[model samples]
Target chain A: MSDTSRTPTEVDDAALIERARREPEAFAEVFRRHAPEIQRYVTRRLGADPAEDVVADTFLAAFRQRERYDLSRSSARPWLYGIATNLIARHKRIEVHQLRVLERTGTDPVSDPFTERSDERLSARSVRQRLAAALASLPAGHRDALLLVAWGGLSYQEAAQALGVRIGTVRSRVNRARNKMRKELGGVDPTSSISEVHVRG
Target chain B: MDEMTQLDRLRSEIPTPELSGAAERRLLAEIATSSQPRPARRQRRRVNLGLGLASGLAAAVTMGVVITNGDSGDPGQTPTVQPYSMAAVTLQRAADNTSKQEELHPKPGQFLVFESQTMDPVDSNNENGHSRFLSRSKRTVWLPVDGSSLDGVLFMEVLPPKPYPGWPLPPEAKQEVGTRGPDRLADFDQRAEYLRTDYAYLSSLPTDTAGMRKHLYLELEPGARADYEAWDRVGSMLAEGYLPAAQRAALFRAAATIPGVETVKKSEDAAGREGVAVAMVSTEAGERQEYIFDLKTYQYLGQRTVVVDADKAEAPVGSVLTATALLKVSVADSAPVVNGG
Candidate 1:
């Protein structure tokens, strides 16, 4: 009865999406609540210059396709990531090339050493370079699955749903990708400070 | 470098670019105004030149509703910036000549083997505060050309600096090795990835010269704007990265268009490789980066950084910061094994 000035945080993504289906103005609240994180995720994959367009395209696509979103999923993170991956794939050559560059250089193209702290935990430049090379060498589907879980914070099932793959496929893809990385990188210490950094989107 | 450390770094160290406050507001404002549904029509590519960065994404939302309904134009084009001219002619010539070289396609199992004398400034403290000394050492690295489970490459020290015997090792490395003497060569793990190069990424560069310029110049502004060295960055990338044939040519062509490019008809590099050179001097930094190429083949010989002004570099003029000379690049079936024992 007292739903007049409900905050975006009070409700879930699915509920907000359902409301936007009727009163599309309400969709702006959805953008306000999650745009920063979504924008950050896209920026992690694409550099800032292209991230601007990606963030814009992602929300607009989400807005237009709001009706098709499954109401069962409480959180929209997976759906948003799926769309972000789709837009990223639309520029596949550039994406892969950028990944390769990151891998070869042992440094993120987006990282500005002046404003940001150099990750001393990175164990020097050579190791980071190897990791980048390993990541760049991964199969597209496998990389997507691994990244969806590791970077996107999606569960295996959620990743499966995001990539439109079976749970088994997701498991294998993630396993194969992780194993390859471990083999190339030497057995990684999962408890390291670096692994703990991906707590957010 | 250890593999696990690298993986951890990849997860944490990579910096993510941030969204500007105005960008978020602009998107939200558009959404606030265009909430009303409109008649559906053929989606044409709409580009708002006023906002170059957001035009592509804004187009999607603007199309279905009454957003940016003003400039209704054709579909699929974003407004692009104009190109500036510099010493791109020399770069294009170099690229063209390099591209014409017989392409050496390596099978997946092979490695890209290179031998080089890497010269870096090794700063040491003695009775007299500190001094920067150039240390030249020979290094040979075998990098896997294929993404294979072999999961390893080889790094070897061919020659240790002898005259002044200087190879700076981290205190941790010194403690780990428990050695004060510079023997240089040592048996290493098979999984060591001492050399990192991605051929896959090289071919992915913009085939068109203009596209290459756009990609580099736009990205360079936020990073190198202080020294007006964006073109130099592009030139350095071309000189350093092993770009594919077409893209390499395109990069050279693009470099020709950069501003303030200077050429020296004859120059001898640190390694004494005789070649013609192209350079860019950063007035503020009082340093210059020169990329030397063979006169006959225009093949990249090496690159070096030299101080042009003492006040800027905070060192004596003519001091060399870094230098590297490429010796040989070839695809080998496997790394040449040496018995360290």
Candidate 2:
């Protein structure tokens, strides 16, 4: 994993975790390494306000459980992601509510600031709305599986590890979730239309 | 044009946020606290060492009130003025004396400088399990007259560590025996506005007894917890807080009316100045929170927490868990230059 591929002088996550067990101050390094990505993931899911709380709590919980970390996995990404996913699960209602709002309004509250002047935003509105509707309608477990694979960029194996599910379960959930999204989009290639609009623009 | 690609395009513009500095500091503080060793057995009592800033005190004050069975008498009942109660008499005298004392008037551009000494429990762990000791320090704080705790500057010098009554002093205890920074006191101040101790806020407080009593119980749920919280508020205000003589007198008068207050004829501050004290017992923690006063002058001396029940407090009876003596309070035009700036 990219996280484990550190420079020769740098210590890996496992060594940092071991050091933190003795001198708790070393845990600050772990936070400094991954806080940005974790904060972004949580903000994407739960907006800005609750993301602050969830991200802080995730790191604190991770620090408390550092002694139990499996050192065999050199990368702390999966472990940290798993902890964040669990904390995000507590805000399931907020996530679904946000998605439903986007689906109905065709305006993503979470992405408004970033897409305010983007060239492709207006052209891709319908596709974004359909995707939001499909995502909001899926079973939470399936949505978790699909997003862990898609947005989180976790491999199926890593997704399974993060969600504490069997690899087959993650595979089936992602397949089912994709089928549902395809049906919601009327079996059309939504991304193709957006890219075509982008070409014309 | 797979579903996964379409999903990725949705809300893909949501930028990655910078982790908030406040959240980072809170996490670091939590880690520092957890690094300290705690008792092997679960601690039923909440100890308010009043060690850090007001944010820490706000949380400790809230948790210090543990609900006890029937002993609280009736919940939410307004405490009747027990004119003959020794605590009430002593507090009234203190109020009279406070009203006559000269008060410092800090302006908005100036600062309120507070100097004090404190002793609080310090716990740590290593290959050997948890170890506990008392960490003593002398602190001088320069707080802006009209600003949040974030604007405050603190300078602390660590004193030699003492054994926590029965516990042995660990070798690591002496590691921090030196002077620390005149750094920022708090990274963030999430304390509610009513809990503010800045000179500007304190000056705006009501200067009448009934109004002060009502302020003490502001937003507090009606019950024994409210009474204890009101008492805690008084301590927070008196510690590192300077008020005008009018408000100060009203505070003492209002504090006397809190339920469960009693008189301790003899009490000693962290500075070892023996004085009379007004105290309230937290039956849950089995400790009495005392606010000491000079016997003859009736001047406010300091505050301390003494164990009243060994089993519940996890310490011998009369063991002092934490103590503080407010050495001085003065007005300063500016804080000393820190970091050579």
Candidate 3:
């Protein structure tokens, strides 16, 4: 093993990648490191159960393409984030379907859709309602770029990778998504709207 | 309206998802069985290696072979691998009026697929050419090409080789393990061959836990084996004509015109294949580029771009462009001959 004490962050990523390269099992180390963040990310976009599958799928995809991982960069967060974004994007129809289902059934896995909790649920529900309407009304490119960067925590660059578009293009999509959301929510910007939505919940 | 707050609020609202315990177990099991196949003498060697690594000293070694789910196999049971699914918010093209699907599948392939946006490594107005990244996470179907199971699956995540001190500048990690061509490519092939031989020996070992342990080490270090299974795809593309040689200079010139192109140079591959190695700064627009051309035939071997840094860059972080002849260009049966009208 290379000297850990002297190993740099990039070197550590290389070692993890090399380990992942040789033994698909070695990818588990990378999963362990990033799974929590990934899990949280998925849970936010999708509920707990769906999040689980998405997280697993993200790592599996990363493991399969571990060799393609650019060693020039160390952190796997952006790459993983990119993968998760794509995974989530694929389920857009299901997401809308799920929101509608929740609207009707009032139950999602993470939170009690039935319980009219006055905490975050109200805001989440309002957000869910707005999100569903906003999402459906959104241009696919704009919505995808915005959601990937916003929920996936991917930087503009990383979001661009996930979307396979120029950074300038990503910026535009994000701007459009936000502007649309703002207009729909009475121009209450996604940021403060979220806080108010949560506060009243 | 600050970018960070907007991004943070969005992140908080839409959380990442999770996986079922059963699926996780199955995936791990699949990886274990496929990547690590055991034999005897090498098994003994692996026991020693495992002991050395685990304890850092060779002491009492009570090696245990724990086959988690290997017992219930009917050999022909064909494990019920999970299926992949997707839902896209189709977009309408103004010119055609036909809805264009965006960010549908993450990685589009034969079995499972995850179609995503085309990654732009370098922001050139080059239509139909984007540095898009593909990963298996979006989809879950195993590839059926050439008897490749999840076990023999080889993925190449482009990583810059080890750096020289303060590399990668501020915001980005230095590119390590830079591009490989001809000589180094040859060297890599040799190494793969050596690992294959080692694997052969390990596989030949008697069915014991110790032997299996040895096989694990041999299979785990992807670099130990010189004959890369995946690169053969790159080589085969070279042998074919998908990437014409004359267009390489044009491709590079096109790449150079990209907004963030940097560090262009002529270099030899690990296997002695002649090509150019470029170091590019991270930009939402800058895309990594690679081109391999046969010096003798002047035929384009392979061209690939990979996303080097995703944080300050885009998702494909790196990418590649294979020869054109090898491409299985598909067109709709009733589609227009020119523009698929």
Number of the top candidate by DockQ? 2
Give lDDT per model, in order: 0.52, 0.71, 0.36
Tens digit of per-residue lDDT, candidate 2, span B101-200: 7788888889899887776665453324346676677778888999766667778787786666566678888987888778767544545578677889
Ranked by lDDT, the better of candidates 2 and 3 is 2
Task: Return the clash pairs for model 1, or none.
Answer: A103-A132, A185-B3, B45-B75, B45-B76, B86-B257, B87-B256, B88-B255, B88-B256, B88-B257, B89-B256
Summing lDDT over every window of 10 consecutive residues in candidate 1 chain A, give the lowest-scoring window: A192-201
State the lDDT of candidate 2 residue by residue for A36-117, as single tens digits.
8888877877787667767776787678778888887767887788877876765788889889888887767777756657
Write the number of the candidate with greater DockQ, choosing between 2 and 3. Answer: 2
Scored against the true structure, residue B266 in model 1 reaches a CA lDDT of 49
Tens digits of lDDT, candidate 1, B1-341: 33433443453544543545555444443333221121011011111111111111111111111111112211122212122332455566788797668776766677665555445433332222222333344444454565431232334232222111122332322222221212212112111121112445455668887887775565233544422444544533433235667877877776666666667554445456766667666665565556668888988777655556644443445544455576667777876553331
lDDT of 1 by residue, A120-169 (tens): 54444444444566677888788788777776667888887777779999
Model 3 chain B weakest 10-residue run by lDDT = B86-95
TM-score of chain A for each candidate?
0.81, 0.89, 0.75
User: In terms of TM-score, which candidate is stronger, 1 or 2?
Assistant: 2
Model 2 bad stretches (over 4 Å):
A1-201, B1-84, B126-128
The residue ranges of model 3 lying beyond 4 angstroms of the native Cα positions read A1-11, A100-116, A121-128, A187-201, B1-27, B35-341
